[model samples]
Target chain A: MKIIITVVGNDKVGIVAAVSQKLSELQVNIIDMSQTLMHGSFTMMLMGELNAEADFASIKKELSTVGEQIGVSIHVENQELFDAMQNI
Target chain B: METKQIRDTIAMIDEQHLDIRTITMGISLLDCIDSDSHKACEKIYDKITRCAENLVPVAEELENEYGVPIVNKRITVTPISLIAAAATDTDSYVEYAVTMERAAASLGVDLIGGFSALVQKGYQSGDRKLIASIPDALMATSRVCSSVNVGSTKTGINMDAVAEVGEMVKALADKSPLKCMNFVAFANAVEDNPFMAGGFHGVGEADCVINVGISGPGVVKRALEKVRGKSFDIVSETIKKTAFKVTRIGQLIGTQASERLNVPFGIVDLSLAPTPAPGDSVAEILEEIGLESVGAPGTTAGLAMLNDAVKKGGIMACEHVGGLSGAFIPVSEDAGMIKAAENGNLNIEKLEAMTAVCSVGLDMIAVPGKTTASTISAILADEAAIGVINNKTTAIRVIPVPGKDVGEEIDFGGLFGRAPIMRVNQSSPAAFIGRGGHIPAPIHSFKN
Candidate 1:
């Protein structure tokens, strides 16, 4: 299923590198990506499709752990939720 | 759309109090009936546990996947009165309530509703027994919520049942005022209401279905903040836009749960139900609408606009919209309402006026232990009269705190929230209540 991985935190170098490395390691296919910086804070939205055998909860926990170590907050959610709310 | 939708949803959950309030699985227990109450209870237990076994875990999965909080996972069953009517020997529905509680505990569901009876017109066979048993049944079970439908728009007000409910609520309060939170008296109560202390799976509903209720008063209030000082048209339009987004999320969750659980999707109850947290209050939304305070003179007008906008927005977002879908003004459950009540700014009469525009009537209000039973019945009659004439759903959940008087507060804690005992006009309604029978349906009810 498609998912959106959002990373929001104070702007810093290597934030994208850290996230991309984690996703590549987990074999998640990043379909699209967007990033913006405002008021010294960074917001990145990554659209990805998980493999058939992917475990979203564990992947989310792992990514969030990386975010914690790097002083950021990461949210992983099914893209359908956003589609339902905003694209309805 | 430039990721704004994703960002907006994330902010709503993180900052605003957006949530799927309850995913209630409504199960029909009509087939659980048996001549013996024990057998009936056993069947009821099996049916509920089997139907709701995955309710909690499934909701958790949805919460995790969607990155939103599902605050409650509830179950509603056919009114126990109907289920136990075949058990003519059952004097009290306490055993049935106990069974419901056990099933709820076993399934890990938050609360089990449908410990109820529909006596809108008059009492049926098991109706009086169930009504008599409510105090005992509620006190006897931990997670069993109870309600009675005393009147309807078509059936008029059942003054007899309304009077009895007043005594029942007092009796429940006498045992433990906290249990009063589990009971509600209704006028024109719907069958698919997924809310607590009032939800019952109607006979017309399918065997099993998924009904969802949404909460986002904070988000709505935040939206209104942007439109502050704007014209009323802009204010209403902004609210509709926010409500549409909120109810659409509810629709997705309901549909997903139904597909996963193999249950039919019933409806999305689009209510701005508030929590005790400061930011998440329907009253705050009204205050945001420019009311000095919730019980202020212009409050009803504000609530009417909100109620209408929510329904209008929600109707387009989902196929079916039922349940008590409006802005809830429960005194205790809402942070803004609690503050207003504690300061003696919000009175019971004003709340009654507000109820005509909102869904629940005098909800989560606490009165002095000395308040007479007839007074509570009179309050119910007034609210019922509003519902009957206006052709809407109105419910009352009042707690007469034992050994407490006005101004003192009772902390129910958790989702039930807290309430400062509000003064009830002590003039006795005994003569009016004593003239019990039926208050005929309003003239508009004769549309046929």
Candidate 2:
């Protein structure tokens, strides 16, 4: 029900707005988000709830297309799994 | 309640080879040792179990909250040899090892370090016994680790002890070569390194602590990959920049953890330590940094530059910088290092030379067990000599694998990995090792 979509790759204008529009269209509420420029590369973390009907695969596939269009790579993972990475 | 910008930063690191290497719980065992060895062992087991009980769940919770991967949750205790010193016989070592193993197993920790001795000058009876029992002690336990500091700058080198430990290591290797993977010998060794078999809680540490080792050879490599064919100065700049970001994350997390755990936060070791995994080799970073191949001529100089630059950058990034906080090049642990050794481009001698400039000495190297203890001692003496002279921390995790010769392989499985049996200088340096005494502190050590 909850997903974190990370959009990273080339620094460009409207990257955030574009992703936000996609989430708005999908009716996914953006719970939290943050972005920063590290080492001149643009990185972003977006936490949002995916509509229950929208499975992860479809969301990922759609984001992949959007990512390809923008010349950046995108990844979507479960919030639970994302949190586990911090344990190390 | 995540902000718009935080989400974006997380997206960039995905599938990009960022993960927390370990979440180690530092437990003080000083309260455990008793005049009676059996009682001491019991106290050790009980203390470790109680302190580490919440480690896994707490780490899991932190992992969830922070969105960073924590690969291991481990426990580090006061040096086992110190606690086991009350033993009248060898069983104390075994009993202590077994108890530590059982306690670690209960806490679900994969391995525990500090099954160790801190004999920089000469051996105490307990230290001697612990060294002698290492082979059987390690062979009998699954998760226990052992370390001994045969020499130190303040104490010079203890050649005789180094030689004997070498022989004992050979015997240990002979018993179960894999178990040899769990021991380390050191110079100016730290008490709070989370990575092992070299890591051990030192006499200087608090009752419960956490040390963070942040590694990013891949991140460094990726940064270098961008500036391929750049000048050495540019490469240095790129490395410093990348190290800053990597260390910032460690500093943030370490501070947060120290505050939450209510223990004094220790250091953030900014070593670019590598695993056997691909794209994670510190040596590869060198090659990427303009070396034709690792272990080539000038390799040590290159490493010295890299190691120094990392410390400079890291010290600037974090207030509490400790541990073996230079680039680590353990031969068996990094695939790139193993490849270098396999290709004959890297040898024990060159590795030792590199350690003088980097963090930790002769780590995870497998030497021929049959070699005279004197030779092993010589190796230890030589490494300690460097540390003492330079007044820097260095260590040796040499495994004289039994029955394995130069170029042969000894597989220890998992993170310990397989070491290509490296050659030892056949010449015996026993006469030198036999004359053991304190090597007084270096002039540099007087700067305090």
TM-score of chain A of each: 0.95, 0.89
Instruction: Give DockQ for candidates 1 onward, in order.
Output: 0.84, 0.12
B45: Cα error in model 1, Å: 0.8
In CAPRI terms, model 1 is classed as high
Model 2: residues with Cα > 4 Å off, grouped in runs: A1-4, A7-88, B1-16, B87-91, B437-448
Q: Tens digit of lDDT per residue, candidate 1, span B1-448?
A: 3577788899899999899999999999999999999999999989998988888988999999998899999999999888888896768889999999999999888888999999999888999999999888888888999999999989899999989999988888889999999999999999999999899999999999999999999999999999989999999999899999999999999999998888999999999999999899998998999988898889989999998998888889998999999999899999899999988789999999989988878799999999889998999999988998899998899999989998699999888788999988977899999989999988888886
Model 1 residue runs over 4 Å out of place are: none
Model 1 chain A — which ten-residue stretch has the worst lDDT?
A: A35-44
Question: Reference contacts recovered by each candidate, as fractions?
Answer: 0.94, 0.06
TM-score of each: 0.99, 0.83
